[model samples]
Structure formats: structure tokens, C-alpha cells
Target: MILHGIGLVLLAVVTGTLSVLLAMALIRWWDAGRGTRGMQLPQGLDSSLKPMVLLYRDQRLVDATAPARALLDRLSVPEDEWARLLQWIGPRFPEAMEGLARIDRSGRFECLGQSGTGSATLRLLVEQVDSGLLRITITDPQAEYAGIVVDSMSQQAMEEELDLLRRSLDQTPMLVWRQDAEERVTWANAAYLRKAEGQTDEPIGWPLPRLLDSPRPVPGAGTRTRRASLNQNGAVFWYDCHSHPVGDQVMMFALPADAAVRAERSLREFVQTLTKTFADLPIGLAIFDRQRHLQLFNPALIDLTNLPTGFLTARPTLFDLLDKLRELRMVPEPKDFRSWRQQMSNLESSAATGHHVEEWSLPGGQTYRVTGRPHPDGAVAFLFEDITSEMSLTRKFRAELTLGHAILDNLGEAVAVFAPGGQVVMSNRAFRDLWPGADSLGHALACWQNQPETGPGVDALGARLTQPDADLRDSGLMASPQGQLLGWSVARLTGGRQMVRFRLPDPAQQGGSQPLLAASAG
Candidate 1:
């Protein structure tokens, strides 16, 4: 009996122990299953738990739930948080604000989002928390309960975009900033911050330093730009600041314009130099643009054309300038106004194509040489030079040469001039009649040697004319094939030239030649 009792006791203890172990196992299994069910609740319960709620106090966001905050983070606006919310929800629920206003009296109100295909229907619930506070809840029943999956995806995309924008703004060399309605700096990019920090050694704080002194009452709507200068480290840096209005705020951008400023300064200096040079030039210079407008002129042009200083400075057209010259009697007179206009047109056309030159003789006995040259970009330049003195001198020299030739032709002697190179320089009419076709010294010598009575006297005359540094004067006599007595003399002239003269002894003067015969007899 004692053994039976002990065995029963041991069995009972084992049964109790096993029962306790089984109960603990059942509890753990139940807890695990309950936990899993809790993790994935029904869609309705899930939506209720993850509500998007926003608490606002006098149009200012005081508190917001995680989901509501996440939604606001996706919005990109320059307005405050409450404004951003209203702007985003207004499109979906046009009567959202009116409903909120009536919520104080109605206690609560619900707004259904506009119905659209392929989009989840949204619900906006507004309730008065107090006299000055309101609570707004936004829900989408049609959306699936994706838990953190959808949130993570949306958050990732937004984060990537935010990162891209941040990097771009920071890397850009331009200074970018945003200001509120009261002109308080709300946000600025990295470049702007750096510049602010450079202005002062102190650490930059809120309301970033104003790098550019933009005009007041910032322009609304369209972009307005102006140049601003900043002194950094004792060096002046120029920038082109562009401002644009966004809602009640303004976004400003400043681009570096140092290179452009330097280029413009250089161009101005170069133009000044050219103007000074043109002022001193003797030739009248006029430059006309492609549109036939007088773009540039020199003082010499005024002096030569006798146009008023004010008229030239007024930037007259080509036709206007020409008419002014005509009125001043500076241009050559034409038969009629019609022909003059046509001539002017032709002159302009010819000048644009290539080089053109024309001479104008004024009634005042002045001559002008007008030259037209083509410039780059279809421009034309005209140069006027006074050549009256040169023309007069040329005419006088030509008259003197004519008189000399006439005097030689009337003389009884045939005269020919030879250059140092033995080439015939000039001959009179008498020389041509005496020695037909003797156009050159060599030809004339051959002709003289062909004479029937030619002797050593002819040879001696040729030698005297051909030899360099010969006697200054030489004379001889020769008889033609017709027995005509020809008296020849060679004389040296200036510039190493020789003049040879052949004279037919006059019968009246032949008796005077007897001394020459007696000398020959001696």
C-alpha cells in the first residue's frame, strides 16, 4: 500500500508539472498570435489609428500628427504652414475654408473631396477645439492600409528630391534668398550664407545679412534685375541681382557680373581712344551704319562739310546729312533734285559693295576726293580729302611742258633729247620732219650713218653723245644725200641728259660760213 501510494504521488506530481508546462506553452502561442493580429489590423481600424490631424491657432500651426506633418513636408511653397495646407486642400475641397468657419457654431463639419476617376476619395473633417483653435482631420478610406510601406516609399522619393534641390542650391555660384512680406529673410542658399559670413567675422545667425541692397517695394510679377556691388576682403565684386515675387514673399538671385563689367569698361575706353584719334585727323571721316544712320563722325568732317556741331551730334541719317551738305553748297550741284537723289542712292549702293571713289568740284574752286570703303556688318566709311592745290600744281606743270614743246617746234633747228640710258626722251615736230621714223637714239644714229656724204664727223658726234662724262659741248657739220648742209651740235643738260640740234645753214648765212671753209683749208 505504501509503494502504491508513493507511485501515485510521483505520478500526480509529474502530471501537475506537465500540466503547468502545457499551460505556459498555450499562453505563449496565444500571445504571439495576438501580437501578429495587432500588427495587421483591419483597414478601417488602421485608418482610424493613423489619422492625419492638424491643430491650428489663429492660422498658425500649433500641433500636427505624424501623418499630417508628412503630408505638409511634400508641399513646396513660400507661405506659412497653415497657408500651405489651405492651398493644397483648397483645390481638392473648394468649400474647406467655409466649412471651417462654420465649425464654431456647427461644432463639426465634413467635406468630401471632388470626385474624380482613378483617384482615391478624400475626407476632410474640421472641428472647433475652442474659440480660437481648430482641429482638422484628413482621411482617405479608399486607400489600402499599407502601414509603413507606402509611407517609406513616399518619404524616400521626397527625400531624394529634397536632397537634389539642396545640393543644387548649395553648389550654384549664384546667391539665392527668400524674404517674407515684411522683408525679413526666411531662407537662403549656401552661397548666400557664405557671403553673409564673409561680410562679418561673427557666426551668421537668423535673418541672413543683406548682401545686396535691392530697391524698396520690390517689383511684383515679372523679374526685375539691377546691378549691385559688394566689397569683400577689400575687393569690389559686382553682381546682377534679379528679384521675382512669389505670393507675398520675394525670391532673389544674384549672378556674378565682374567679367561683363570689365568688358564694358574696356569697350568704352577703346571708343574714347578712337574718338580722340579721329578728332585730330585732317581727312573728314564719316561712318554710317547698316540702316544708313550716321553713327560716328569727326571734327574734320564738320570743318570740311561746314555742318553745324549740333546737327552732327544729333545723329542724322545718311540722306539728311547729304541734304545738309547740299544746302551748304558743299556738294557738287546736280541738274535737278531727282537726279541728285538717284545719284546719292547709287553712291550708297556702290559704297556698300566695295571700294568706290568720286571727285566733287565745288563752285568755290575747291576739289574734294571722296573715298568710300566697306566696313564690317554692312557699314560704310567715307573719307573726304581736299586736292585743289594738287590739281592746280599739276595743271601748271603741264602748261609749262606744252610751252616748252611749242618753242622747240617753232625753231629752225630739229632738236632731240636723249636720256642717260641713250633712250629718246622727247622730240619736237621739226625733228620728226627731219628724221622720219627716228623714234630712238639708235635709230637716229643709223639714219645719220646712211647719209651719202656722212664721214668721221658723224661718228665723232655719235661718240660724244654716247660716252659718259664727255665734253660739255660739241659741234660738227654734215651733208645729206640731197647735198643739204646740216650743222649739228650736242650740248649737255641737267640730270645727265644730252640735247642734239640739227640746223640747215641758211643760204643768206652761207657767206658767213666761208670762215668755216677757210678754217677747214688751214
Candidate 2:
């Protein structure tokens, strides 16, 4: 009885100690549940922890945190619908459930999802915890991959298009260039460099404004201006430049002025057409310098003067042609020709008038209606037309009207008649006046006529019989007793006889040189 009683007392002591240890363990576990920072969870226990979720089903989704409400609104799901989603999500939730199962079995899951009109992917995971419920994680993989693809495609297309644009720009004829916001040239085509035309030894990368003495201003983001330049050789050109903001740089496009080129070409064509129109005109056109040197002579002038075409190129002086005229007996005399040419040349140099028109006595003894026009640069133009045929017609008309006898006897025009033997048969009042009572009528023509046998009158008569258009004039002493100075002319009458004219000095000046004589004998 005493041994059994001792064992029972020891058992009571052991049982009491076990109860005290159990109570302490329960208190410590409760403290850990309240989250003691010092307590470390086991590895497998982390999968069981759950976030503390506060549910308020009656509250509007708008009342939730911005992020949470935004996510819900994007899905077009209301708060009540989400709160009661367990029944409505029967179909779509299966896919989410399957993904969760796989995550629980393998610690991670990846699956695709179709949300509204778009598609997505989910990477869900269930993490283990030491003491809490399981954690469910979801992420979208489709959105991430889609963003990467879009960025890659945009970069590739941009590079391809830029390559094509660069090639096209190089092939263009006009210069093209681009500049940064700071007005620094960033790029240019091959034609852009060619415009420099090797004059510039340095590379062309600086701003265009820096190259000119006066550059146009480039205002920022407003109205713009452009201008053109002329080359050293009198060539015209154009440039168009603009400035605008483009990201961190200013974009500028420069091109030569094509419109200016077209305008110039059109103007040149117009001038060419005008010159061509006048080239074939009928009247003689001649251009002369201040020294009476012929600068230009149209085809008509060449033919009328019997001048060689080469004379047009060399532009000979009036004296040159006058010398030839003297040799041909076309001038009254070489001295007279020289004097008259000098007078015309002097008139041109003095700029006596801006323009004038008058009759010209050609060395050939032809009367030409001429127009003289003066230019600011000391150049002159002479236009002429022959009126000899018109004068002949006028005389013929007078003869038909029975006015020839009256004109021959009373007209102030000097007149003389030559018999077949070269004797003077009759003379007019004007002719007697010129000789101052000299007995010319019914006398030998050689007594008063100047160089009766070998003078301008003889030469003119010979040419008139052979050549349809012929003339002569000369200054020489008369073949008379006194050898007086005389100017003479000869023409064929309608009946085929010869009518002559003689202009002599008055008796008051018979022994003196005549005042500067100006006469036309044709």
C-alpha cells in the first residue's frame, strides 16, 4: 500500500507540469497570430498567408480606391455584379479555376484569356503561407508581348521609308537641304553641293545665312520670306527656305527657284521671236556708231548698197563705203563724199537731237527717204527707202496732164536740154538765174555744162540707158570758156530725148568758190 501511494504522487506531479507547458504554448501561438515581428515562419507555411480583404457589397464602385475602381470600370463590371459574380462567372471562371489548380499543383500557371473585345493572358500563382489562407496571383502576358511587337514594327517601317526618301531626294535636279532648329545644316542632297560649283573649297554644312553679306531673317513659326541671287556671269537663280519647329530641331527645306527659271526662259523666247520678225522686213536697216562706223546692216541694206555680206560682220565705216562710191562715180566727188560723211559723223557725235528724219543724197545720186534715230549709248539707226520710181510716175502723170511744158518753163527747178550732138537747145529761168544772165539756151552744152563729155551727167546717162536703177553726181569744173563750177544731172524724157539740169554760181560770185553746195541730182 505505501509503494503504490508514492507512484500516484509522482504521476500527479508530471501531469501538473504537462498542463502548465500546454497553457504557455497556447498563449504564444495566440501572440504569433497577432503578428509578432520576431517570429520567423517555416518555408512551407508562407504558401498559406492571405491578404486581409474588406468587403463592402452595398457601396458603389466609385467609392472604392481609384486603382480598384478604374480596373473594374475598364471591364465594364459593376460592384454588385462583381459581388454576385460567383453565379454569373460560371463559364469564364472555369478557365480561372483551372489555372488556379495548375498553380496549386506546380506553384505557377500561364494561360490565355478573352476579356470583352480584346484578348489577354494570365500568369496566376498560389503562394503558400505559414498560417494564412492561400494567395492567388494573376498577370496579363498578352499585353506585354503586344507592346513589344508594335514597337518593333514601327521602328522597322520607319527605317525602310526613310531610305526610299533619301534615294529620291538625291536624284532630284534642284538642291535640297534640311536644317536644325538652331539654323545649322543637318542634311543635303548631292545637287545641293553642286550649286557651289567648285567655288567653295570647304565642306557645305554651315547655315546658309552665314554665307551671304545680307541674309534674310528666319522668324520662328510665322510668316516666311525667300529670295534669289544672280551669278557672276549674269545668270539668275532662286532659293526657297522655310523654318519650323520639329521636336528638338528646326526643319528647313531649301530648293532653287524653278519659277524664276521658267520666267527667264519665256522672256528669252519672246525676244528671239521679236528679232526674227524684224529680220525679214523690206526696208534697209543699218546701225552706226558715233564715228559713222557701221555696226549692223540687215540683208536689205547689204543688197541695196551692193556691199558684201562680210561687211556686216566687220562693221566698216561710212567713209569706207563712200570711197567705193567715189570710185563708181556715185558721189559728186571724192572730196565731196568725204566732207558729207564727216558732217554726218559729227552730227552723231554731237547728239544734235534725239531723233530725226530727212532725205539723204546717196553717193549713187539716188534720193532716199531716211530716218535717223539716236540712242542713249551713242548708237544710231538709219532706215531708208528708195523713191525714184515714184518720182518718175509723178513726172509721167504731169506730162499726161499737159503740165510738163509749164513746169519746164516756169518751175524754179533748174532745166537744160541737150541735142543729139550735145548742144544746149533751150534753158529755163532757173538755169539762167544760176548762171547770172549767161547765154546757155541755143548754145553748145559743153560751153556751160560741167565735164560735158566725161562727168556725172555722162555717167548717169549711160547707166540710165543700161541699168533700170542708175545714178551719178560729182563736183567738177565746167567744160566752158570760164571753166565755172557746176552741178549737173541728166534724165531720159518720155519721148526718148535727154533733159539735163545745170546749177551754177551767180555772176556776183563767179570768180569765188561757191558757198557749201547741197544738191540732189538723180
Candidate 3:
């Protein structure tokens, strides 16, 4: 009987010890579960594959992984009650909120959200707990789309945007095309077809490098522009292609530049012709564009300005040209450099008016006439003409006239010359001494004042002498205003010029000669 009692006691001790251990273990497990909200953290989740964030029923942050925090910056949540938070999300993610109001229901949603970082397309999973708490979870990307069809506004928006972009690309003036990684043309716009159909209609399915004489602007270059030329139907065309890479494919936009190329060629030819024409011109030609840069110059410019050949071909500015000229003593030297700079600017500005004329007396005893005239498209042209001969001849003519007057001053008798019109051609100092108040040269004969009041005045006599059929009475003797007998004789000279001379007899023999001639005649 005692053995049976001891066996029951041993059984009781074993049961009590087992009960305590079980209770301790249950308490430890419950304590651990309290911190984790009674849910296992899904042992060893692939965090690298997808970030995750969990929310409590109280709308408090429960836990988040590394990438989850970065993504949460994009998901805006109002700091309010859990119900209100769910309501706020309901409008934007109505599908995600279907079971949000209930703790026992489960729901899933995908949405596009905006935050500081940019746009974020995310997914939300809502799960219920036995403790009446909501377990909200977030993942960056949802599972692959299955049989359940879900269309969102973001998807519609992307499709509409893509459609609009396609339309815009078609309407654009440039020829937009896409090429595969092999550099073969796959698709093209209408502009590309219009340009490529010049000789043939097969642009697609052709390699871009074959169509061009040279493909790629530079080898091993990144996305950039290249000028390409093609010959089709006996015509050459040019295109400036803008290229960029789009994931193993190249997107190219070709701009039509054939007209621009032709225009440039025509301009080049025209410039050559102008150069040839200006080569033969005797005048120096220098043309400056609107920007005040020397564009065109002729050989005569070098000869006139004494500038070096290389200096002109170097494409110098107007100011630079002036500075060099001043250095070479070719142009007028400026007293002050600062003031001359301003003056130089003014000269160029005014030269565009096309009416500027200036004379430059160079240091080499030469004179130059510089003229500036405006040309097409706001250009200025300077022409230098040598006028040294013209100036020298003018000076010589004046000197000879002065010398002739000096010689006439030493004469004794008074002399006068008249043209066919009775106008006094010239009168010298001898004539002026004979008649103190006689009219100067070119004086009219109709208004003589200091002559004798005979022969119907000097004007009538001169008129009769010059008449085609007048009495040849161009010579006669007349008394001066002082009652002196002056024997005047008029005779015709060369060039339709007539001369008048006065005779002053010897004072000792004049009275006896008159009476002797009279007695011999009797």
C-alpha cells in the first residue's frame, strides 16, 4: 500500500514540474509576441528584392525596412485617426480601401503617389488581426499582372500621353526616325519619307550608313549632331541629324538644310566673282560687315594702305586695321588713344550712311580720296582713289597766273584785252595805273565810268566791234578824263581775243612833226 502511495506522489511531482515549465514557456512566448503584434516577421524576407513598411491600426508607424523608409517619403499620410487616414486614401486608392474599414477583411491596391522625390507607383496590402488591429503593408511593385484585370488613371494617362507624343512627332517639321542597334532604319515619319523618296521609296529596311557618304560625325562619339549629305536623282542634299540613344536603339531627327547649303555655295561663288571684279579695279576696296569685321578686301587696298598681305588675310577688325595703319603711319595719327577709339567707332557708325567722303594726305607726299558707301545687308564699303595728280595740276595753274600778273606790272603803256562778247578778259597793273578807277577783269563794257564821253561810251564801241557785220572801227584815239590825248588802237588777236594799246609820244618832237608834215604837203 505504501509503494502505491509513493507512485502517485511521484506522478504528481512530475505533472507539477511539467505545468510550471509549460507556463513559463507560454509567458515568454506571449511577451515576445506582444512586441511583434502577435505576427511573425516572415523569417528572412528578401529585403533586397522588395522593400516593406507596416502600419498599425492606430495609424502609427509600426516598422520599416531600409528601402521602405526611402519609399515612404513619397507616400503622404495625414497625422490623424486611423479611420480618417483610411478615408483620405480612399479617394486616391478606392480599390485599396475596400476592406480598410473592417479589421477582419483583407484588401489589396496599387496606386501612383507623389512626394518630394518624384512619382511613385506603389501597392498596399491590408490584413486583419485577431486583436482587432489592422496590418497595413506596402511594397514598391505588385506581383505580375494575372487574370484579374485592373486599369488605373495613371495607365490611361500614360497611354494618352504616348498617343499625343506620337502625333506631335508626326507633325513636327524635322524627319524623326528610329534605328535598331545595328544602325538599320526601322521606322520613319512622313518627313523622312518625303525626303528619302527623292529617288527611291525604300528608306526603311536600309542601313543609315549606306545612305550617307560618311556615317557618324566622329567615331566613338556620344549622342550628337552630324552633317550628312546624300545624292539622289542627280541632286545633292544636306541634312543635320540630331541623334540620341534609346536603349539599344537610336532616335534621329534630321533637319532639312539643303536650301541653306545651296545658299552658302551661291554666296561663296558670288564672293569669288566679287573678288575677281575688285581685282581689276584701280580703286582700293575694303568691305566691312555689320559686325564691323573686315570681310572682303582687294589687292589695291594693300597698295593704297601699304598693309601686308598676310595682315589683311588675317581677318582683322576695323579698329585693328586703324591701329595697324597708325603704327605704319598710313592713317592720320590720333593725339589721344582713348579719344581716337571713340572717334573710330563714330567713323564706322557714320560710314554706314553711304555718303561719307574724306581726304587723307599721306606722309609720302600723296593725296587719297576715301569714300564710304553702304552696301546690302548693313555693310560698309570703303573706296580709296588717288587724286594727287588732280591736286598738283590745280596748284600749278594758280602759280602761273600769279607770275603772269607780276610781269605785266613792269609795262609802261596801258593795255586791255576783250573777248568776243565785249567783256574785259583781263587788265594788268599797267592799265590800272593808267586808269585809276577802271573796272576790274570781267567787268561789263556797258557800264564804263572813267573813260572819255565819246564813241557812244566804251560799251557801244565794243558792241559794234564784236558784231559780225559792224564797222571795223575797233581802234581810235580818245581823251582821258584828265584831257590827255591817248592814241588807242584795237586789234584782233588769236582765240577771238582783241587787244587795245595806248601810245605816249616823245615829248620834245611831237609839236614840230605835226607842222612839218602839213607844210610839205602844201
Quantify how close model 3 is to the true structure by its C-alpha RMSD in Å. 14.9
Tens digits of per-residue lDDT, candidate 1, 238-320, equal 99988888888889899999999999999999999999999999999999999888899998998888999999888898899
Tens digit per residue, CA lDDT, model 2, 1-522: 999999999999999999999999998898888777557666544432222122232222223332233334444544463443323223433565665445435654434434222232233334532122344333344543343323221233356567778788888775555555455657667666666544465665454422211133344545354554535335555566544555555544455676877888899999778567657776778777777788766677655556667756787776676466455544334256567677656545444366676565556557666677786566777776676676678779978756655666676457766545444566676766554543433233333344323334434434443343345432222322344444555676654446666555456766532322221122
lDDT, residue 515, candidate 2: 28
Query: TM-score for all predictions?
Result: 0.55, 0.29, 0.45
Model 1: CA > 4 A from native: 1-217, 230-237, 244-256, 299-302, 305-316, 411-413, 416-425, 434-522
The per-candidate count of clashes, in order, stands at: 0, 16, 0
TM-score of 3: 0.45
Q: What is the lDDT of residue 162 in candidate 3?
A: 78
Residue 312 in candidate 1, Cα distance off native in Å: 4.3
lDDT of each: 0.82, 0.52, 0.65
Q: Which residue pairs of candidate 3 clash?
A: none
Measured over all alpha carbons after superposition, the RMSD of each candidate to the real structure, in angstroms, is 20.1, 25.8, 14.9
Candidate 2's TM-score reads: 0.29
On residues 301-397, what C-alpha lDDT tens digit does candidate 3 reach at each position? 8988889999998888888988997788876567788887887677777789758888777777888888888888998988888888988998898
